[model samples]
Target: MKKFASLLAVALLALAAVSLGTHSKATAADKLPAQVQKIKDTGVLKVGVKQDVPNFGYYDSKSGKYTGMEVEIAKKIADELGVKVEYTAVTSQTREALLDNGQTDLTIATYTINDERKANYSISNPYYYDQVGFLVNKSDNINSPKDLDGKTIGVAQGSTTKTSLEEYAKSNNLHFKYMQLGSFPELAIALRAFRIDAFSVDKSILTGYVSKNNKILDQGFDTMEYGIAAKKSNDQLTNYINGLLAQWRKDGSLQKIYDKYNLDPADADDE
Candidate 1:
């Protein structure tokens, strides 16, 4: 009886060791890059996106849901990872900080890829492309950048649109005072209230504001390349996203997503 009890204890200890080994192997598969591994382990992907700018990444107040091209992209990534998604609304001023400070795992809020941004953040290959444009009230009769002289235009702070608009104005010998709004929604309100004569932003963003009373200018300007952003030096996360983007580009899945928003597929290609 004593010998049998000792053998049983040894068998139990061996079984326990095997179980721990199995668990370690299971978790080893989830040891992706720190950022991605966190999502895998937590089973949730936190994405930062714009709460305004329809057809891009707008939060529908009526539905309490977000809808747009970038939102679709974010959802697709979450689905691919077999994880649930949580979105945090962000503005131009907050998007970079959110990613840099680890408040969000990724940012897909129509983020533009530029040399300055690339120097500080890891950006995926271009997923969508658009040109700078102006949004003006129909009553303004402002048809061109030349007409913008002496007018106040609203632009999002820390956005490429601000620099692009200023460059265009300088090249055209037109000067306009700029009101640095915090986000697209604020700029829209400022325009409607006559606090600003126009809103300068990307054509994709301006398209969301088009209506009988507002129109996106016919002419497009400097090109803007949209990318998914991660923290700088996060090569594993960046490469993982780039690989997925490459596959989506080849599979027509990316175009289908753009089509769902009634966006032009031509404008949704990698550069």
Candidate 2:
């Protein structure tokens, strides 16, 4: 009787351990959807982007299609993975949320990877470097950000550019009235109409805007590097992307993409 009771207890304990292990695995598996898993399973890639930020990511009015440096890179990544690519358009505020919510597999928008974002998401290797800069009308007499001390500056809402501009204002003991626009298009319109003294955004973006409308605006200021963002838990996806980025960097494919857009490329040697 004593032996039978000990055997029964051991059996129950083993069953409990197996049940707990199964439950833990199920819980982790539930974190992301089968769609993302399907990407891994079928080797298809899904990328998220902004359909408005020109030259970096945007829908061409003439072609009525999405095309840009980022789009090209996304295509290259999908090709390397031997997968079909699916793109989802996301806003600056919604990009990470979409990734966290598993709505998209990867974000190639000019996402700046910072310590705060690192806590919530994994960032792929830096594929491009951009700094905050100002765009002013050529006739505005604003050669640099310093000239905007007492003028009104326009920025898109929910952008790192806003924070960087504010910090710059505070640090320099400057006082510039800031106008928050809902999108880059609106900001450009406002700048063209002279509703604001200048518009501030990533240097690459400002360069693109100026390139498109050199008659109206010019680049003025510079801020930080940008990277792709993925879920922090997706180590497999993150590693794969980082490896691809490194490969692109080594073969000059990354530089070619930037050159196509007339952007100054940065590499490991760049500070």
Candidate 3:
């Protein structure tokens, strides 16, 4: 009877040790930064994504699902963290505000990695590269960036593309007027209606909007690096996401997602 009791005691002690270790791990996780800990505790990763841009991110009304390369990337990150995804629609103007206000943990809305953004928020390494391009009506006969001289171009508000376009014009001694639209859909309509002679933005964003009359100009400008942005204060979460992106790139998962969306993975700058 004493021997049996001794064995039971040892087993109980071993179980207690395991429980303590498990608790310790959980405690450490909870001690992480507020954003990371909240995600762990809530099992939800709130993400901001564009609802209109195709191949990057879009909501299909027919299927009632959001599907695209950026969406896929967001889902992969959530899966890696063992969390559920909750997407919030964001436009170029609203992406930064949503992240700063804690409405979203990550913004994967084809966000450009630029100097101003890096100073304001934590951004992941470029997952994709996009060159600026001009989308013009086929009837407009614009074949080059110089053709945009004295033309009114439309761009999304709160986008770095507008600044880039202006700089490109100034550097080439080409003068043009640019109108800031509220959204991408509006830009497309303006361009089609001749309200704006051209719409300048990332080439990838202009792909799905292309029609027989509207074509993406072959004149490519400087390449812009796109990155996932998080709040500047959430370093832990940003680092975790960066590490996740690194793993995905190495394992070919990122490339597969890009391919599934019909985007060339070769365009991604893993650096």
Q: CA RMSD for every model?
A: 6.7, 11.3, 3.6
Q: Name the runs in model 1 displaced over 4 angstroms.
A: 1-35, 265-271
> Which candidate comes out best when scored by TM-score?
3
Of 2 and 3, the candidate ahead on TM-score is 3
TM-score between model 2 and native: 0.79
For candidate 1, lDDT tens digit of each residue in 162-269?
Answer: 788778888888888989978788898898988999898887788787778888878777778889998897768888899899999999998898888888632543
lDDT digits (tens) for residues 18-130 of candidate 3? 99999998887667667677787789999999999989889999998998889988998888778899999999989999999989999999898888889999998888887
Residue 164, model 1: lDDT of 83
Taken over the whole model, the C-alpha lDDT of each candidate is 0.86, 0.77, 0.87
* 157: Cα error in model 2, Å: 1.4
TM-score versus the correct structure, for each prediction: 0.84, 0.79, 0.86
Error of 3 at 34 (Å): 6.2
lDDT of 1: 0.86
- Count clashing pairs, candidate 2: 5
Error of 3 at 233 (Å): 0.7
